[model samples]
Target: MGRHSLPDGSAPASTGSRPGARRRTIAISTGLVLAVAAGSVVALRSDLLPFGEPCDGQSVRLDVAASPDIAPALDAVAKTAREGAARTDGRCLDVKITPRPAHEIADAFGQRPVDPEFQVWIPDSSLWVDRVDAGSGTPLTTAGTIASSPIALGAVPEAAKALGWPKKTYTWTELTEAATTDDALRLGVADPARSATGLLALARINAANAKDTKDGDEADTRTAAAAKLLYQRVADGDGQVLATLPRDDSGAEQGNPRRNQALLLSEQAAYAHNTGEDGGPDLDLFYPQNGTAQLDYPYTLVDDDETTPAQTRAANRFLTLLSEPGGQRALRRHGFRTDNGRPDSEVVDAAGGREPQPYSADPADPPSVKELQALLGMWTVTVQSARITTVVDASASMANPVPDRGGQSRMDLAKNSLLQALATFTPEDEIGLWKFATYLDGNKDHVELSPTNRLGDRDKDGTTHRDALAAAFGSLAPVPGGATGLYDTTLAAYEKACGAYASGKFNALVIVTDGANDDSSGIGLDSLVGKLEKLADPKRPVPLIAIAIGAQADKSALDRIAAPTGGSAHRVDDPSQIHQVILKAIMAAGSKGPR
Candidate 1:
């Protein structure tokens, strides 16, 4: 994601031996000779003299913004450097370490034309660096990583015993299921939107679920279910999630409904809590059999034209000091892995990790930007209620049979996918249905079959809105001799969705079609797109999520139509993938705010 690659798990190489007394004397003699030859009236500063000279009054001060979890350790290292009078290019180093959350710093840097107050940054993961680089802001020069910690599930002693933490090694999927399905476990996680530890852990869980299941729908279902469960007990960040744990070691406190018995946490965090003087219950860590995601504290330089050469050298010098023996010892004492990411047995034992657990396993690959965005989007929609109006094409070609779906028609697969997607929505969400075919509505290309209403609402016949929508989805059939009216249907659906925009809900339009527009008499493509652009309002965004279903579908046209509303278009070769596409599209759009 950036120009600098992550550390390759190798120990830091030696920079070379210090200058000997003879070498220092020769350097001093040489400096005096040069000064005499120059015949200058100005007196030289002490720092310009020799290697062992005392620092002058002008010390280079560098402000460092470090993630809270690692700040104290870095502070200790800074203190040692200050006391030792660490110097770079003959100038004394005065480094100030500030404890700030990684997300807060990332947000600040993500803005345009960032003028960061700090000269250096050490976020919990390189993911934050990627985020800042993705934005239109001042670029960062990554020096390297300082420390690392793998993400794991932390459970109280009682809960750990129940799950057989040390003896039973479970994959991420199995661990998630055990935590979410058992009422006694009371699992919680830091909000993915705020915590890298939380987001990375969730991504690993999703990847594990996908790998274990052959059926895409089943995988999606499992992932969504786990997200919902975690959402119900989500904390604001790593610190907050740990605070949700039982305060005391008593069995009664462990069973408290208001407290969480297990949480998604980093090994360092668990170690801090377990060894803190606060006298709280200790946490036993579970390293997933599948590879663990790690928090690699990357040391990044905030580079700009305003930065002085002295400050740059000072920053690089500080990074070098951090990888040295003294700095490594300090990091280990604070419960962090060294830059190489190799597990230290003492640190692992303190964090409640045991042998046979995959604590030393290689770190999982970092999630891509697209994957992270989609995961956040899904988390947002799953936690928040949505108001979606889905429109389906009922053109004559919809009856075309899928290649490997046991003779099932495209319509059949589409309907089944829609129903599966419907189940993921909460009752608080609002949903509606529409079917479109040329001349099917006696002049209009699309007709509304169900009004957008809360899924929990019931009619006089005691039928829930969810039930009605499901029935409507199942009833969708191809109109005999009908043609695709994609352009007109899209315009009409978007207009209606915009008009009935639900405040504080993920209000949007979803369109599913298997072919390009075949009705030339209907509105033209350019005209439809122009109308949608005119109607689209950023304040009340009703993004148009278009899904093109077969080889005959026009993805390019759909993309143009979707662009105006800040929505996206997706094409799937098999109709059975419509549900996954819809979920991913929803995630992509939802991450862009209300849309």
Candidate 2:
């Protein structure tokens, strides 16, 4: 089962709609130039087939929206349709087109189901279908023109030559080992958050690392090693550019191999870049020679939301077109080949050709519902990572308040917000509470897990861990306290609370002290960090984090600990903003790859 309480960063809601009549943006290559200039074709075609009454008399209006994140192949598809090749059942075609922001599409699935009335909603990849299913709707029909290019090295001729590419071959192990030895090499990919392709690239790397053992587990040593490699590159400033990029942008150096970039680009962009007009840096796609994984973007027909059987039938017809001989021929023109072809067949040794193999996915085989559930489950471990050994300012000087949710004391607001956030848990995520300024007492440093009694999950023989944790938070009385243990408390939690679950889930050391630090100096903080770092997580410990509420926190200390350990030390000028901010941070924590 997945955890409750949506964390903030998991997926930011769409802010607003773009101006203009919405048009679907499909990734298409230039089919032809406009009659006037014949030179404005940038890259990818942009065309849409006109809609009309279905030849079979079925009024199936498919409002197609391409994932705005990917370049629209609309023009390519449109040009084909204009040639009368897109007719359904040997007649005209009818469909409306609209373009929504990429983020909006991710959000849409979270809120409402794609209109079942619409015959089909094609995102860039079928993997997105998995994410969309995780959210709303009785999943709709999804299809893709081509699956992603299995990740390969998109390097300059020199880089490829140096790696023994076209001459030799590369396996994931070769790449990782090379990076470990030579720190200057760059690997490209798109931002995981921005592009599903990048995320897949990351997953592939993780799986490659995980190949040693196929134990059906959530995380493995290889994944942790890969994440550490990524984070180190991030912490090492912008120096790790060539080593890591989103899976997509790892191409001809993004016109700046001189100055490394943080994110990667999509494989299509990488291909286009190496072959573009300004593209002569000697580019090559080094397919890892030893059995690489291909993303099989299977197109499935949605039958759940149709008025009549004809509309559904029409949708299936489209699927048929995608797999038929003509469609397969079109796929080859766009650099794809039918899966059956071997590296030996007419499968031109080019961008999108290779033998086809059965993917670990099937609309019915793997059960998307189960995968969606798994994604959410892994996500929960990321969010409730650490329970801050929160130390609120309760002294006489701290009594004044700031604006909070509906105007409440900053301290009280902080308490309520923390309570609400704690509520977003499965017996797995837990937190600790403390109040301070002059004196500290009353279950300080007490960490409790969320109780899952509602589902009859007996984490503690009969009591839900959440209930136990809730009781701990409730018992946190604002006693007259002073002098927060900025670093010491954090160090304490490393040993005291979070240490218990360090290996299983993310166990963080959180501190919500008021203002600046009083005693936790550099030397003391160093000692604390050293101890925390030395300790690996428990068999399944959650992550740890520290928060500074209304000052009274060792800024430097909190920052350092959270940085490497997958946590954050946040400073709040106004107390009322506590709830939303903490929630947001939790969501960000969810985005981390396993710790």
Candidate 3:
């Protein structure tokens, strides 16, 4: 739109001289400027331009952060949308795609349960939509399809044959028995805590809170009962439950071999990565010989202060695009079911090689505030896990060596780091404080210290229960006990952080520990992991971050806990580094995704 004057006396063109056609040139040039401006204006307005067209040159960026389960499909759809928008409106559409597992989808946008900042959230189910609504007070305003393959079990042909896939329906008994008795028949599902499919599968097993009526044809499920069932089964059985995953065609990438051999995830997710296209084996799918639950990936809206109207608009547009023909085709290619298309043969085959079952999802389910309350209620109980409770070693071995940096006693550095870590949280972050090293009873018992108010339960002005949090982290004086119960304490910390808090708050469990597992006092690590395995939430996760100090720091164990819980673990090489380590722990805990 910049202006330019015609050079020389072009105006003289009007005065004879083959300067003829002067009026024609002026008219043509003027037309081009107006045309370009009009085109730009039109381009600026559309988000999805229809099929076969390029993205608009001026559309706002439609950055989509999707759980990995649906990212591929969405990315393809977005690209098509960009093309269409461009062709129709002469606009530009730029798309940025990031992938994460389903559980972390909520955290990508908002600070609290009710908030999300992304233009769109494509989690694996309407269940996620419901959970967020409970916290944010509505189904994320943006709408998206709950399009997904039925939640089913995937088994290799040989495994299916052994499990009696076609002849007998596969039941919980089959899965449990395989886990307990058949070491070679490993079961796979993403970690329920991090993946939606895992959580959904657990819900099915626990008959998850199936509504209970006082005396009607009552089949109501109690959340506690379900938790007990799931926790007991996994904790008691030797199942390979993966917490995080390796990204690859066959998922054959190396990891801590002890963690797991298989994963828990949606049937579609399994298909997308493990099938022929990935140049891997032809995975067989089983609908568990049981009725399948539909996994609806809902497009949600984040309502926290961080949300903006553009996000809403972009999200809405994205939803519309998903339903459009171009988006539909792309979703189909990625194994997503469509309103108008053939069932994905891959999905059909893995579904126990059976016909696709009927499926439906209700995104309009009103958010239940009580559900949020219920999830929150679980937090407190999770914290009091029996797995936690370590033995502290106050032996002569303790005082001699230091954790090196700037020469502070290992214990002193750990304490200072913890204190500094506490400050990293603003009033908004929910932090559960716990301190070990001292036994309250002469019998050497670990104390819960004190409890702090729940996160997001703060007053309108945003003040939290500061005093309780302070009391929990009061001191770390070692008591007259055996060696430090590093393993047991870590176990206990896991339960406290993931188990004790209420839902609807950011989960950050920061543990400061010094050495080996010899001083076993609290719950054992295996038992603690057992409890953690059953952990579920329609909302946020209870993240655990730890800092190891002293010459005796058990960095390996700490690292294990942090990775599975979506946090970090570090060894403070020097006393001066403790503060930074603590702050990092706090930040890592506050962060969302993975663990």
Candidate 4:
């Protein structure tokens, strides 16, 4: 999950007003200073700082950085620990806890030298630990989890009751469809790529979508549809989603009933949001019937050269303290489960009298690393905006009238379908236009109608690229003497995509054609495939998707051409299905190139 900073951008209150509180206050403030300076955090400065602080030489100071949401609770524990804290072989231990965003610390470790001040780190999810380990190649020593919170669907009582919540079990498919297809229900989520809760929720949705997949493309297509539907309603951040939620009816204004219909959030967040609610329309946690993902707040010790054996022993002592019954109770006050994954009775009573029932979240339900990478790649192109070069066939065959539609030509249907498909893309997504046929642009088989750029962008002439591209689409007239130039045009398009690939965007080439190569001057299929394979680069991938528009379209030839670039080819006989086909193709694109 992305880091949740302190609510007011201020550190937690000092546990006491005595000398110990003052000492801790300085430590917290100093830790924040270091975090600001480093663009990361190593919480709780050691007494050795300032070069002359009075401290017992035998005292072990362990600096611990914790997730923001749980930091304060941990801070409280640290305060109690100070009076008579755990000892390592008769040596006094001073444990300090500071709130830090896990992402920044991970980035710091990957990009810079490690600071010796930080002895232990406790990120919200194991996923963040894995990310740092993968990047740094330095193993982290972890003492299991301190607390856990299951990711759940938070819905207003009205919506939950309407769906038979508590009384009925609902699958992720039903929730996804309701949020995406139903006009009345709005599903809001944070960006899955950034939020663990959102990522897990999406995993459930994907699992439900791909349950009966007979082939990879079918699975990709289904998952894409689900992602696209949910992407539309996402808020900018997790807090925003929580903030929009309706409050309990103490006659208080919670969230917009019209806007905040359902949300994907952690149980801790839900409890914090609806503190006084009891099965009301404002806050009800629904553990999906399909299962869920939990955030296991693992206590990890940094096992690098910077860490000493003394600090390691101190970390072990602290871990033992956190797992004790008293420590578990303190963590439960923050809405996390006990070490064993069961809700604390006090916590259950505090939220309401009803204890949250156990659902089917098998430990392995969370996506594997490979699955996560694929999903993230798909999200980049389909849900998030992308940079795409669209190549359309403008050969004589494109001018043929549709078989059944009144008087609509293949070009007419194709243009309309392409425009409709464009509607699914965000304005931030840059798209360029190209048209192809034999001898269409001097000696070239394809002509660039507009440079690959954002749609709403303007030139010196003040004409918007979107308007210009739409006009270009409207004005296209199939060349009467033209023949399909599939191989040459595809090669040219791929070159253009590569030359203009934006580093941050999902760059791709989308080709829509109604026939196979017929150009005498174009290279043969064998030569084209070999050339494309040689040009393919995983580091700078440019996936090519070929869309065959009719029965006469050559699927085998298109598939063979697309195979070399880790792209895919799809055939759609009906123009109405073009939108769905385009979505599916985009999901599968860029997922299988050089790497």
Candidate 5:
């Protein structure tokens, strides 16, 4: 997926004598003779041999799929192992290293059919391992971590000086704000959807802001603001983002709009750039004072039916070899920290680290899966303009008071939550509103309160579309003697969304209800689901995100109808949680690629 490509051959070598076969043969024979002369007959045993005997049995060959950044170093160690005839259970070990982007491999594993060509996976971070585990894929056994690299902000000398780097230490928030708010320091980042380095850094920033704020909403607002700023200068992936930096040490090139002054990257990446022969300006690294997220390269074993006992043992042996001092030194030479989390001063210095920087400080705790998902959700929404048609239940039961919201009715809380959620969207996003209840409109169960339009669009009165939507949301009230008409309203909204599908935009229908479908005269559940299934198109998807409010809501029915449209159903005990659930659902739907 990047500059690194697979080796000349895609398959592992056959089990046999290797290039140094003659030398191994000589050594093995001499060792046996020496043992015999010493009168230690038992030393001739394969297990007891001081130096392992040449493989009398078949060699155990393993294909290793490693992250691109670490593949070259691993290949070196593997080559050494091959020349030295590394062995497990008297059999020689042969490992072939292939450099692959972790995200591509993760997507492969996420699909059906539990089959993988490689026996071992060494992604740059354990986050990929977690992603695989979260999906329905072949199980992975993580033996241990092999290397580590901390995420940091890297800036050219000129930009670093502007931020008072090397002498002034700033927390994640302070550092990000200082860099992003300045026109002179244009910050760039790899898309969080693609780069762990970017996502982890953003999560760290969120966590740091959360500690300084009073609640989750405030923290989310601050993080979203930062995300919007970053989206303006985002790149697709690590390699592409790095390519955005100035090509030379000239001020003219540095001021180019296409070149980035600063970027979020791993320490090892910075080191590589500084030490490369490209003749570009070296970056000055800043390890946030709040702590940095680390890329813990976990050595995971792919346990599938194709795996053999010998291969398993060989995988374990290779892991042991990687943890040895020789392997650690090799990794350090490649600008990575060993598994013990100790920073190499040489590498740090080469990466532009100085005394005031917290390069050697303990890594920040890894973000939880949920936290990462939420961050991704926010990123997805912030980066892409959405076209959403939201339908809220206007049944009489909505007048029921919420338990702990200072006697606010369910309708009040729901409207307020929707307004709060609306604030998260940008002016480019298109949104509309509908209120539904049986017979709310003449011979219909749903009525559009606001027509879908870009939030920035202005009417004859000079009122923005966003203002109109907000006013409509505020005017929402339960219809007198109205009954739930979930089935009819959902179908109508979904059909409208699909018919007006905004190509290249995140188009979807959001239905929020506090009760089950009560309009029996409308389309049956089976009929509605069938129509949805027929309308669902992979090329023009319109996922129906259904949110059930309170204990009285029918989540099962919502789930059934949602599933056919590549959507999902969620339940919230409190209406105030609708905003969060909506974002999470958007994340989930957006991630289901091509479906």
Candidate 6:
């Protein structure tokens, strides 16, 4: 939700009691000489200004784009600045504060040319600036910090009291546990890919989980696991995310079951909702003890060749005016703090005499761009339930005993691991089983044991696919001196997966192999990869993940096949580590969409 307008709907008021008041209100635009051409005042366009009609005498125009939350206040400031006929050098200063979606603006910086008139952009946080800078390779100058808001947990008073939020501090782990496992507390958050607040909350959780493990892949794995749980909670429920918040003033109780507990939101948002008359419920703020992400409303200058020197001067003057008492007053009236991070009297009064919690100016560092990219990728996979077809290699090599295990065949271990992996999946996940070996069934190397359907579910034959698959796995034995028929089986499985692509689910094919392709009658590696590449669709992806179970497996060939479908190939020499290897395969299986 955007920032709320002042309750009284008044102009910028003087908050003299604020700590370190800058100066008395000064009207910088009064008594300005009109710039006339042909003895007529130049009329401005209504579309340029977000709110009022254009100023008649204004000559110099400065365009400012701000996030929607603060757009109202900035628009009010611009209107006041225009009414005063503010002057820079010898012409009237006209400021236009256009409201824009933060994500759209970041995307435009890299894919489209920025509008020529925009001189400054004030996004809700420096994160947007970082995104643009990283994407376009253009350096944006940070003018200064305009306002400060921290992401915090907004819990109903009852829930807050149960968690001892205000009385005792809690870490993100504790909070996540309560929401996911400890007590099944409903948790609501925004989509991290789109919401800075959501991203910060998830980042905090990931960092905490990372700190508890040794650095390297172990740390990444732990963080990914924790983030997976967070994503699952949101994915499995509806009406709990920020985008779907209930609109009723009475709030969660007659609104939606998903939103009846703690929600993640910015400090200003929580205060605005709580202070409103007849607002839903009393929300207690929970500030994590390990620190939180702050939105420092970065005032950034858009430096490009298209901007003229005169427009630059006008922009600089507009910023200067905003720093003045009147400009700061407008900001304060809208529940924003001064540039120095001190809340104005208006905010304090709205808080019912309670002071906003102070947080470390230097909070825990946010994830790097690369780390964020990886995290988002992981979330994309785990957020959706999956549909998978497991294709197992039952060639003669499967009968080989594990080098470490005394007598267990590789096939036996693989079968057990597959069963264990099923426990990791929710009942909603759909799965099927297949086996490939030379001349296994009526001269066919590959044959399906069960049809693709929801696990633990009965098919048309009145037999549960789960039981059928388990029976098939337990009874399978290596064909006498059989060879691997990898190419034909993989091609057929890929076709089946593509044909059965399910919407709103991660659809994939998992191939568990023990050796290289030895079938001379089938398509070659190059031809198979080319065909897979051509068949793969970004809009409806079906990645083919391959797990090589032992040391002698052909990893290079598997990589070639998986690369075309945006999947990965994993090699595990130790059969005991198959569980971890399957987790890796699951991540790789669903990783084939947009960045």
| lDDT by residue (tens digit), candidate 5, 1-595 | 1111112111111111122111101112222124335533432343322254455556778999998889989998888787777775576788999999888887788675367889988888777777777775667766557788889999999999988888988899998899899887889998887888888999999999899896887898899899999999999888889889999999899999889999999999998889988777999998999888888787777767778777776775676567566777888888888746778899899988998798888887788767787788777777788999999999999999998789999999999999988988889999999999999998799999999899999999999999999999999999889999999888888888999999878888899999999999999999999999998998898889999998899999999999988889999989999998897798777766441
lDDT of 1 by residue, 1-595 (tens): 2222222221221211111211110011222234334522221332321244455675889899999899999999888877777775567788899999888887777766577888888889777777777665657766556788999999988889999978998999989999888877799899888899988998998889889897766776777788999998999888898888888878778778989989999999999999998776999999998888888887777766677777776775676567667888999999998747888899999999997789988887788767778888888898878999999999999999999899999999999999988988889999999999999889988899988899999999999999999989989999999999999889888988999988888888999999999989988999998999999998888888999997799999999999999899999988888888888889888876632
lDDT of each: 0.81, 0.44, 0.46, 0.68, 0.82, 0.66
lDDT of 3 by residue, 1-595 (tens): 1011222111101100111111112221322234334433442354223445543345666566676657878787766656555322233555667775554554432335443335555566555544444444323443334365556555545555676655555543355445435655555554345445655565554332243234311211234333333343232111233222223334443233332233334556555655434343344555543444456565544444554444444554455456545666677666776552235665555433554322232111222323332332332233222111112233333444463345546555545555654553444444554444434334443455545443335556655555455444455555555355555555565556555654444455556655655655466666655555565332546555566655577787666666656567777655446655544343334323223
Q: Count the backbone clashes (under 3 Å) in each candidate.
A: 0, 94, 56, 3, 0, 0
Lowest summed lDDT over 10 consecutive residues: which window, candidate 4? 16-25
319: Cα error in model 6, Å: 5.9
Give the per-residue lDDT of model 2 (tens digit) for 205-299. 54555464665332333544454454333322111233343223345444454433322333343444433454244345555444443333333
C-alpha root-mean-square deviation, candidate 2: 19.0
Q: Highest TM-score: which candidate?
A: 5
TM per candidate comes to: 0.83, 0.48, 0.47, 0.62, 0.86, 0.72
Candidate 4: give the clashing pairs. Answer: 157-281, 246-255, 247-254
Better of 4 and 6 by TM-score: 6
Please identify model 4 stretches exceeding 4 Å from their true place: 1-58, 107-117, 134-139, 179-182, 212-219, 247-259, 276-282, 348-364, 390-430, 433-446, 449-595
Mind sharing the TM-score for model 4?
A: 0.62
Query: Candidate 5: misplaced stretches above 4 Å?
Result: 1-59, 88-92, 399-409, 460-462, 537-540, 570-577, 587-595
Once fitted onto the true fold, the runs of candidate 3 whose alpha carbons sit more than 4 angstroms away are 1-48, 51-56, 85-90, 105-117, 136-139, 173-184, 208-264, 276-280, 303-314, 340-343, 350-352, 355-595
List runs of model 1 lying over 4 Å from the truth: 1-56, 107-113, 132-138, 250-252, 395-413, 438-443, 479-484, 517-524, 527-531, 534-541, 592-595
Q: Write the per-residue lDDT of candidate 6 for residues 225-256, one digit (tens) a residue.
A: 66666664452211135333334435446246
Candidate 2 stretches greater than 4 Å from native: 1-61, 67-75, 89-91, 95-104, 114-118, 135-138, 142-148, 213-222, 231-270, 278-282, 300-311, 340-595
